[model samples]
Target: MKLPYAEIEFDDTGERVHPGQVKDAASVISREKATDVIVICHGWNNTAAQARDLYTRVVESMHMVQGEVPGAASRRMVVIGVLWPSIQWADDVDSGAGAGVADEQETLQDMIRARIDDASVADRLVELVPRLEASSTAQEQFVALLRKTLPASTEGEDEAAFEMLATGDVGEVLSAAKGGTDAPDALAAAGGAAGIDPMGVAPLDDGGGAGFFDSIMGAGRNLLNLTTYYTMKERAGAVGRNGVAKALEALHDAAPDARLHLVGHSFGGRAVTAAALATSAKVSSLSLLQAAYSHFGMADDWDGTGKDGAFEKVPSRIDGPIIVTFTRNDKAVGVAYPIASRLARQIGAGLGDQQDPYGGIGRNGALKTAASLPAGTLLDVGGAYAFEAGRVSSLNGDAFISGHSDITGRQVAYAVLTAVATGRS
Candidate 1:
């Protein structure tokens, strides 16, 4: 089915806009004389079709909400779906199904060693090492190559010590390479030393060490996933800052007085905030639905630097209320987010403790932020929740939202409409 809203597709870099589409989208808003423009962004690992389906659900839900709220339909609305290439890895492959041979029962250490010695992975590394040696500024060149080779969603600075490997320090590089082979054992030993489970969970013995090996292999696979996850986070920030932000600036120039409302799902939350920070676009309302960004993104002061949180200064840019939703049912943010953040920190991503806390905005509301107005009010679905201007309202999404991808429910649509209507009023 066709979406009820206009759609604008952006390339992977978030810079190039599809020709004729923006003008057509602008025409729709102009024709309707739309007072409010709602832009929706999707999260990671979604195909274009999936994004469109999500937009469809959101539009339908908004229609339902408008039916219940009198005078809601009187406001001319123009909905736009921001389609950016934010996918990292395919869903099926990311499920850890074919990572290790099912029949081969190996310990966690053995599994790490196997991945380290993986012929395909090693071959790529071997090819990369020579290229590093052949180039000047070998470290930077190598990192650039890795940024190209790695399946991260965003491009970012290399903070990890992998650059040290290319500084004519063959011994250090070889030692680091060798350390990869010994990582599992070292990690397990450290865990044992700390009086923790070496297998990362309860000791499992399903005969022949099958269960133990499976657990170890799972952890190893998670490392790979962490790489992609961090990449996606950086990419989301880039797309928002560079691509979406620029686009919004241009749109505002064309329609200076137009009211803007941004709704981001998962990583899109980071993107929308980045867009706001990157531009002087005056936003009316910002809604983050199960955002997969740092919970401290809206903090007043983070890590003594005052500029640590991704959206710390977003309030200054927005002219109205900022609404955020949180739920414990989002497994991606609840379970995988902290693990990925911890691994990214270990690799020198320079992710601060506050910005890279154990929980996400999706699972927990904005935390450590003294500036939150009303301190994150929890709203009931279909209930009257008028958002106060220049404040943040954190709503509990457990009643209507179930998981990371369930933001298109009727209740959520109602809540979004409430925010929009309240901001416009």
Candidate 2:
């Protein structure tokens, strides 16, 4: 195939290759040095497309950083593009159950989040997924990997199964949708506030709790969790359990030097936490894109904790650094209101935070990233890739600034990728 995108390199004497082709070529990539392992996880109702197995952003981001720090890519590092079954979160919930044509740029951002441990440091993390005693299917392989790769001990509630989906009862949504209600409406009735308009059934009213948009931002913060596709939806006895067990068994037997780096987008972000809290998998870190705890169902707050609840159990178990990338102007965030409303709310909540990081998508369809950073820190990790974005695009053809997703978006991807690539957190 003809190679496009000059920035991407492929020694295709054997075959002209592109980034897409390089991403999934695990064997080819594995042959390279094992310096840093970066695994990317995708968001809800979606699966990481390991097809052809090439990570384009990994290459692009690496090159971008190398320009500043030199030798960023050549460093002993293994770029492992981890493809997990995610629920596939998207901006247009109008698409039937996340079965939508995805924007590559948005998807790529989510992938970036999963590769870093930022999501794992979520208020809480779930237990490692269980492995089945039989069947080494791709899903099962991952479960086994977690079982063997994580630490020997942990603490948390193992609310396994695609608990959230089951909670809403996919049957109910399908039944109502089949009965003629629009899919969004059906989903609202099942999982959101009464009269949700955007996603259909729930208005997601922020209530008097905070500025409607800002108070609801907690939802935006966790919106990425929706991107994960349902898998090991099986709990202890469910299909996911056995698959996890089998995978863990194999991992337990692997060479001790073997390490696992989890990157989950959207719902997958929560799953990664689950596996981490459950197994003795020797993991370097976790990255969450569009992250939210799966087991933590629809609730009154972002904390998503409850006494005797699985999520409550989860937070108490995993302790690590976590990074989250969210946009105040995210359409899905429903943040059309003024930022002042949110600012006041933050003050009311006693967060002691004072920054307007998300500049609304302006008239020309340009989105600005106005985030707050630690003193002397740019890019939230490495000042190399981060820029004070003002809705500008490197592409002139279609203005490919990027699309929306739980983890991936032009700005969000840059934030997460720069953080991880530079080993910030």
Candidate 3:
């Protein structure tokens, strides 16, 4: 279905694809005399169509629960859907499904093509994949190429560990990926919850020795996924901080009286938060659905090292409550964050779980922030919430948020509306 809301898109470098769309969406607010502007951002989608579908589902769910929010019936709200160049990993790339070695090599090639923008670099990377299982020289060259292709990013908590991508032993890094999280059962649980087969990683020793190149091929795939995770994370932040922030500023100037509500899913959550941090736009509410960022992203001093989180200033910028949803059912964030820790050389049994210092916000919740309020689990459609303004509320969505992409549910819509209502003067 075509997106009913105004659409704004950005390129990989955070430049607006169509600069006029921001003004056009702002004009929409003025024409409709919208009292509120709901901006929804999508994360890590392969195509514009998938992103549009997400926006449609979210708006549909919100319409169904608007009545439950006080004063929502009288509100005239216009929606904006933000799109960016985000890529999704191929299922088999991480799953390590029991496919033949030739099939696995082909799968790795497909993954490289999907995530890497430069065709030549991606082709070179693909060539290295087959050799990964047999040659250390090929392994070194692959890691170097991967590091050189990715954009320079400063989003991680450990700069030294992140720098290891460039300077550390290439062999050890790939080995860490081989020893990374093995969670087919976790994926199964997530799939069961979502009623769909979840993306996952299978053990290399799953019988028959798999193949001669199985273990090294698995390591290459995992490294690719890990690097892709960080790449998308940085790209999302750039898009939000520059393009989305500019759009919202334009909208705010055009419709000064309208309250702005920002809602984002996955990496989009980081985008919206980054946009809010960058712009002077007066945001009334924020709803982050299964966001993929550090659990300590908003923390003032998560490890007592006197260092603040990357988004330490976000909570104060919003005038209303920031509602963040988290769940264990999200295998994407679950598996990715642990690999992130492993890449950073931080090892622990609970690497990606809530107890881990390196957990993603979607797997756990916003942690160590001064604005954090009493935590609550995500509620049913008609359930009540005591969301307070100028605070951060971490709502557990384990009961309802079955998977990473399962954020367009009725319960989530209700929570968003409730937060918006709570922000009203």
- lDDT of model 2 at residue 168? 34
Ten-residue stretch with the least lDDT total in model 1: 345-354
Q: Which candidate is the best by TM-score?
A: 3
- TM-scores across all candidates? 0.72, 0.41, 0.90
lDDT of 2 by residue, 223-339 (tens): 222212222222111211222222322333432333334454443444454555555544444444434332222112323343232332322222222333333223332221111
lDDT of candidate 1 at residue 194, scale 0 to 100:
29
Q: Write candidate 1's Cα lDDT for 19-58 as tens digits.
A: 5666776777777787778888888745788788888888
Q: How accurate is candidate 2 locally (lDDT)?
A: 0.30
**Could you tell me the TM-score of candidate 2?**
0.41
What total of clashing residue pairs does each candidate reach?
A: 2, 91, 0
Which segments of model 3 are wrong by more than 4 Å? 1-4, 89-94, 180-214
lDDT (CA) for every model shown? 0.58, 0.30, 0.77
Specify the poorest-scoring 10-residue window by lDDT in model 2: 389-398
- Residue pairs clashing in model 3 are none
Candidates sorted on lDDT, descending: 3, 1, 2
In candidate 3, what residue range of length 10 has the lowest lDDT sum? 190-199
